[model samples]
Target chain A: MELSLATRTVAEHTVLEVGGEVDVYTAPRLRERLVELVDAGARNVIVDLAGVEFLDSTGLGVLVGAMKRLRVANGTFGLVCSKEPLLKIFRITALDQVFPIYSSVEAATGDGTGSGPTS
Target chain B: MATVRLSFSPAPVHVRTARLVGVAVARRAGVAEELLDEVRLAIGEACTRAVALHNQYGLADLVTVEMSDSDSYAVRVIDHAPLEASVGLTKLPPDELADESLTDDALTTGVGFALLAGFVDDLVVRPVEDGSGTEVRMVWPVQRR
Candidate 1:
């Protein structure tokens, strides 16, 4: 299936909601979208993965690249992913330590008491 | 023994088809429900890696994927890229992977075998004998009725 992307401002943070399968075929779109957001001067971004059904290494790579880009801009990047399968991927890659992952968009945009982002 | 074979042009679009077919076969082969996600992810990674290798070397060959349930559920993704592509990335030992985690180059290029190693307990990457390219084989235990 094709990847779906929607961007909205929430609590002063840009929330990009992603849906559908993210694989080699569809990851570039996500990458492009992330680039657009950063180039548009979105400082704080939270990618909501709650609607995402599948994610692969290519998708993960896109997310990692986005995080690094935002970090370079001295902005904050976080992920809202609570699916066990998707969480398992992050855990396996040890990316769970790299991104500030939240259970929901509210939690991600909430007070900065969630899991801290790593360098 | 039931087996499914898929051969597709080394294109990114075909990787999803390979994953879907691989997971369907794995389920019919009696692979546990909980491990289906792992199977799907592993298959996707293997196919994606093969496609990347082929594209990198400008090869127009087809990537072949085979899944069989003769014993444990096993899947193999074969690519026709140059031999060196396989040599440089496929054979790293586990101990050396700590330094390879999430490198910028690795993420932009290929996630490589380290991520696949995390998903499949039984994983092997080796050069195709009597030919160029690499064969990535992954296995997961299954219950036979």
Candidate 2:
């Protein structure tokens, strides 16, 4: 399936909503969008993955690369992922430890409880 | 035993098709519901790896996938890239392999293989018998009903 990416401002953060399958085929677009956001000076970026159906290592690699880039820019990067299957991928790769993950955009943006980095 | 075989051009777009077909076969083969996601992810990883190898090596040959349910639900993804494309991937631990092959700024080329190791409990990678490319073999237990 094709990947869909949309960005919006949330408080001071940019929330990028991602949907559909993220395999080798469509991950480049995600990467390019993320790079565009960073280049445009988005410091605190949150990716909302509530609509994502499938994710593979290539997708994970792109997320990691974005996080590292933001870190180098002294910015923050987080992910919003509640799906068990996607969560399982993070857990297995130990990426759950690397990226700040939340149940919702509000959590990541600290608008709500900022309740996660969900285990 | 029920078996299904598919062959597609070595391209990234075809990887998704392979994953869908694999999960469908796994579901029909009685693979547990909880494991269906793993099956799909594993299949995607394998097919993606094959596609990447083919792209890197400029191979236009087809990537082949076979799914069979007998002793277990098994999936094999084969790529026609040279055997050297897969060297040391099966031998090293995922992290160490990634570290070893890593460039200055890029993640290792074997990162997908590492993810495959994480997704599949029973996995094997070896050169094809005819000494052409590599075959990634992964198996999961089926719920016998």
Name model 1 segments beyond 4 Å from true.
A113-119, B90-105, B108-112
Q: Residues A19-113, candidate 1, lDDT per residue (tens digit)?
A: 99998899999999999999999999999999999998788878888887887899989999888888877766667766778888878897767
Kindly report which residue pairs in candidate 2 clash with one another. Answer: none
How many steric overlaps are in each model, in order?
0, 0
Interface RMSD of 1: 4.5
Model 2 C-alpha lDDT per residue in residues A25-94, reported as the tens digit of each score: 8999999999999999999999999999988878887887787789889999999999888887777666
Alpha-carbon deviation at A116 in model 1, angstroms = 6.7
Residue range B52-138, candidate 1, lDDT tens digits: 888888999999999999889999899988888776564333233224354644653334455688789999988888589889999
Score candidate 2 by lDDT: 0.83
Work out the TM-score per prediction. Answer: 0.90, 0.89
List of chain B TM-scores, one per candidate: 0.86, 0.86
RMSD of candidate 1 to true structure, Å = 3.3
